[model samples]
Target: MADTFLKEQVRARSIGDWIALPVLIAVIFAAPFFPAVLTSVPNWAILPVSDWVGEGLNWLARDAGVGGVTFADVTRALAAAAEAPIDWLKIVLAEGWVTGAGFNKVQAAPPLSWLGVTLAVALVALRLSGRGLMLLTLVSGLYLALFGLWVLAMTTLASVLLCVVTALVLGLAIGIRAYRSPRTEAFVRAVMNVMQTVPIFSYLLPTLLLFGYGPSAALFATVVYALPPMVHATVLALRSVPQETLELARMTGCSRAQTLWKVELPVAVPRLAIGLNQVVMMTLNMVIIASMIGAGGLGYDVLRALRRLDFGAGFEAGMGIVALAVVLDRLTQAAAHNQSTQAVGLWRRRDTVLALALLIIFTLFSFVIPSLGLWPKDLTLTTAPFWNGAVSFINREFYDPLDAIRTAMLLKVMNPFRDLLLATPWTLIGLLVCFAGYALGGKRAALTVMALLLFIALTGYWEPAMVSVYLTTLAVAIALAIGLPFGIWVSSRPRFHQPVQLVLDTLQTLPTLVYLLPAVMLFRNGDFSALIAVVSYAVAPAVRYGMAGMKHVPSERVEAAAMSGCTPWQTFRFVRLPSAMPTLLLGVNQTVMMALSMLVIAALVGTRELGQEVYTSLTRGEVGPGIVAGLCVACIALIADTLLKSAAARAARHEGDIHA
Candidate 1:
């Protein structure tokens, strides 16, 4: 049966497939004979693109300009304007307003009382959602206050709020424009693809050069990082608006603008809210990374803790970020889904009036009772000693087993895979990718994949790129192995679904930085640690997508399989799995992207990959190398994304054929 199936498969191939097979095979066999030519791109062929790009950017920053003003001057002016609001918000949230510099300064007013802010947030949550969210808001706010993270948390909150607002406005405008013009949409889609695939670190390099080092650069980076998702969400939401709604608007003699504002936008609100949630989460994520550029907040504290090897301090700050993320996520989600009817006048609304009254009352009381303004330092708590003790005990008691597992994994699995990838000839790999692309997609995909790979090779980053690929590939495999089964089990057991989903959601919500802390604490610095961090960070998508796929499988198909005398395992293997293959492949794509993203952060734990290259370039102020390394990482992500999407498409088609 196997031989017959193999023969039939060979017989089904087109002439092009047959021709391509031998060419791929020949390239693989010929690689060893011409190692110098095939194994790597030689010096003569390597392009100095990074240097050229660096020079061009420097000129744009320093020399190139129109009229009397240089580009740097314009950017500085804009930065100054943007900085004004941020500085004001900082004062309002944490740093009380002052009239003068140094010892000569006089306090104009204390910032909003922590008591007031907490009450206001709770009121808003109650008004938009219900008692559950209100309680959650109160608890999260209290956690920050009690842990002595109020000031830093507030500072981070200010930055996040500003960035989210900015990103939303810009994303809406751009998305609306793209919706109106197909050409514009196509162009914007291409740009968004690059923006989404490019590692977050790449964004800081250009922002740093243009805006200089400060909150301005961090603000700009945060906005850019968070902008793409909002734009995507806006476009998708607008496109998905019901056709019946549009027709009704036309029948009612509505103008285009009126149709959009009065009909489409209201309908799109729920979906757009999801985008808002994404923007909020992404802004928080970037804010932490932006701390490296002087955007001080909880992220700065976390960074400082990491540097000092103070695990306790880092955990506290990281939890502060999680608390903030949860609050914002819930508030925004509730606000979007809010369906309560409002009175004619805003002042007539009981909840709104009460919330405002609470804000005013608390702020007024803060002037006489100063403790209400900010959580008193002496009243705060610390878990640093407890955490330190726990870490010491674990290390002292469980060191051998943990070290043994790490060593075994590295020696037996990771190193061998890394060596194989590094030893593989670039030419053979390139051809293999081309053939795979052609087989999965077509000529366009083939050309695109080959070109992207070629660009990486020509830039002289192939070796490190291979290292990155090895780490990501292994991490993704492990994540899928673990997540897929768990997701399947949860999907099969109805009672487990909600709890498992909540766990996955929380994992995804935590910033990538937090994953590094535990991994580094346990495994120290190496591929093993990086692998653990990447897997923990990337596993959520796998579980989420897999569970979704399994849960969505048609009940009719499962019933039919069972009725045909199949056992439960046979029904799943033959019926449910095939039906879910396309979605599972999509899950794989997401897992790969998430893994690649975490790998960059894992560089901090001393992995020698493209992430390290980018980090090195950032620290050394080498724009050219940083940009090149970032692009290489982006290429790897795009390649994986494209191939997996193609495979998913093929699976869907095959499934459809089987159904027919």
Candidate 2:
């Protein structure tokens, strides 16, 4: 009887809250139209968060000292320390180091002949995976050389290697420490969360400030950007080790270091290998963006092409990046999954010896035939003219239709949505967000979003924040509109699946900078170009999740639907879509995050959003403004992530209840 009474009270309260929700929303929406006193955040209430951050940075730059060294001095010294190895690597890989009397280019001397490098890569691939990857590596090397991009690709690869090594070392140390201490784990996790969410562009300026610009600064930014994933992956892998296994190590009188080396690390290899894969991918992703600060390579080639509107050249450079990414991705994945014995008798090590012997022979041959050491310039091919011609043809033939579509999208959809978002009072928007938070995750979430909104407002970037939200919202909406149905259609067809997935993979993995100019060429610079690029970039996840969810649906449920005599559309709409909704929402959350991440890049195409603010601050070296704007972006991402995650959780719970 007491339980029944409590249930009744709870039900009554739920009804009351439901009744009040509409009223609350109505007041918020109507208040904006009524009076500023009721709806708008007061002008006086806007705090100078950026100014405060600037002042802090200035103080550190001025008065902060340790061991008789000022902050700036310390930063410069650290920069100098980091630069030394990078310089050595740069020279060895592409720039040729100095010898007895003068300098010689690596390309001119060729450390390992083109044949040796190609053959060595093939052998590594063969050892790592099998014949297929060996062929792939051979093709990749030939492609780089044939296209006259070998040196440039190698230059990028050199920087990426340095960055990856540094990130891995630091990430592992931190991750291991966190794994051993709860307090350390908590602190690391908090920092990792911030680092992961903060956009890459935000890291650039502060790194430049401290490192004083160059490839080294770019490398520093890349390390900071890519380190979080490695740390998280390491922590996860370590924590996943069974307690029984660990306890056994303890029972055997293993010291902590001994246990970590002999037991934990061996067990953690597969997981760490996955982390290494992530580190490689992220390192590659940063290659192009890092170029903006003078970390030259294939990225510089692409950037130059974009500035010149040379679609052919840009496309070629972009393809080189894709090729490099594919090779690394495959190699790392193979390494992660490999479980071969490394210890063997010398009699069985003939293949390794033979490979090394071939390399040495090729090196000797290169001295006699220098052209073999480096790809002959006369033998290289250029596909840029072909690509340029194609671009020109498309522009001539489809210009009008493309222009109309671009204009219609801007005039009919994007502009109005943006204006509505920008014009809405912060109070109304905050209330709406709070309501959403409350509905999705109760009072705690509501409070969290309220705090996020208040913080954004205090930063004096409210309107820019709204602009980013507006762009992300529209981009995600369009992404879902296109990607969802495509995913559904493709999921039902086996033959189409792999091909579609391959394209999507390329779209997702291709660097963000690759699309900057292609977008401009198609849509011209404006919100349209930015939105187009963002949608293109963000849509892949939605489709990926949709297809995955559908593919994983229970066969029994599907068969039952067929037995019910439902039409294909009806079955999909009623059964499949419902099952996939949770996963789709998770994809949408990813899509939103991707769009926000692209915001700063989009600013290059002329979108005057928070991205532009961050970009402007970055260019002007205004650390305080740049950092605060970045935090605002992070705040926006956190809110969206939280609400969507809560919704996904609720959906999952509902499904579980139904299953039970």
Candidate 3:
């Protein structure tokens, strides 16, 4: 009886209940004065793999002759073949195709004129959305032309188009295969989680090796970065299709291919549209970053402005990026939901055909009037000076206050937090993670967490990893502080919704590089500037999710609280906030992920973290260091994500229990 009772007691205890006290004691005793080996990764234990990777890359760069057939010859041949379409697209869209030799070289011109492009885009927008979107599309094109950004904008557009198409096609193919095979799906999910978590910067080095530096390498990296979202979204959409519907299709004698193409795909269009939207946003986000790897476009312009400290030029390029992101986002979103609306006439439904017809006419007319083929140089305008002056005026007027805020934040918040994180021994941190993981997800998660932590430590990146963790944690805390209040205020007022959402959308979609310039302008370089840039990029999701959660609170619950004579604050605290807590937690997850993604970009402004390690590795063409540091960041993200998801699940269960 005593043996059974002991077994019962052990089984009844939660992981945390059983282990928390012991782990807490261990941390207290070991954290502050731990041995150097326990506190950090020792130099002798460092991986020698980086040197091997460097040697391998050098070997690949050199010519290897096999009976006069050199490796360089093969790579060059393949690269040129792959680049053919990209080169053609860029020239056709931006410079028009040229035909004829040497001195006789003359523009054969693209089939579509600037006028045609504008008209076609507007028509497509009209078909997808309505007159409002159509007008927005027209204005966006005019802005590009009038600002003398048409060529650069078109270059960026062509790159994005190629990347998006390739990513979507590839993602769909993989997603479909994964959907068909449960094992494949599981493996793909694991790979995607890592891929999505890895910083975009980490992708550049290996791609630079395989494709060499230029638009081709950048294109390859962008596709890889953007592909996961599409694949995940496609999987989700396909899986979401009613099993009954699929069964019915199968019963009707549909072959596997037929069921997929004729039944599943049609129904999956809306969900696939969501994936496409993600692909577009991700593609545009990478546009500027890719420029760093020799994929020039408007991103090149933004990079130049960053180096020169020209806010005006940066702002212009930034706006152009925002414009492109907004247009793509709107169009793709509209496309996703378009099928649900009432059907219209052929002219409306076949808008693509109409747009094509108009494009042909406009192109033909442009042959008669050559200026229509390109945006006229004499008509271009630039507002860089105005933006520069505005930034200057703001800096002069608010210098003291901004400086004070920056200084206090560095001294009071960032520095202490970073030092504390750095000083904490890895063993203690690992133990804490193990306990948390076990509490959240049982033995598998605990082991998984420990293994990843051990891997990071063994890579000799433990300190930099801690620095990244500190940066992410502090930035997220600040984002919540600001984002929650603002989100609450905006959510409470219906009148503020659209404008606030628009601004948030822009903030979310704007390139990471754009945030850097403003950070430099305001805080200069340091942890502070890095903090500002990260917060700017990350805060939007927090605000968005908070507002969305509040807005989604059950109406009846609010009414019940009111009837119970609760004050507004009391009602919000007792009713709305608790109900919305799960979603708000989800928002926090997104915010942390976003902040981690910015770590590499933050390093550019002198924030010492794993991101700096990754960036340094990239510049030196050292693959192992970049990858090891990236994995550390991914591990942090994975740990945080698992904990938060567990917490949210627990909250949901508790609420369900209370209701029961």
TM per candidate = 0.95, 0.92, 0.93
Minimal lDDT window, size 10, model 2:
339-348
Pairs that collide, model 3: none
Candidate 1: lDDT of 644?
A: 96
Q: Write the per-residue lDDT of candidate 2 for residues 599-649, one digit (tens) a residue.
A: 778888888888898889988889889999999999999899889998988
Of candidates 3 and 1, the better by lDDT: 1
How much is 539 displaced in model 2, in angstroms? 1.6
Better of 1 and 3 by TM-score: 1
Q: Where is model 2 more than 4 Å wrong at Cα?
A: 1-16, 37-40, 100-109, 251-253, 340-348, 559-571
The lDDT for every candidate, in the order shown, is 0.88, 0.83, 0.84
On the 0 to 100 scale, the lDDT of residue 623 in model 2 is 87
Give the TM-score comparing model 3 with the true structure, all chains together: 0.93
The per-residue C-alpha lDDT of model 2 at residue 424 equals 76
Give the total clashing residue pairs for model 2.
0
lDDT of candidate 3 over 238-341, digit per residue (tens): 99889999999989999999999988987888899889989999999898889988888899998899889888898888888888889998987887676634
Q: Predictions ranked by TM-score, top down?
A: 1, 3, 2
- lDDT for model 3 comes to 0.84
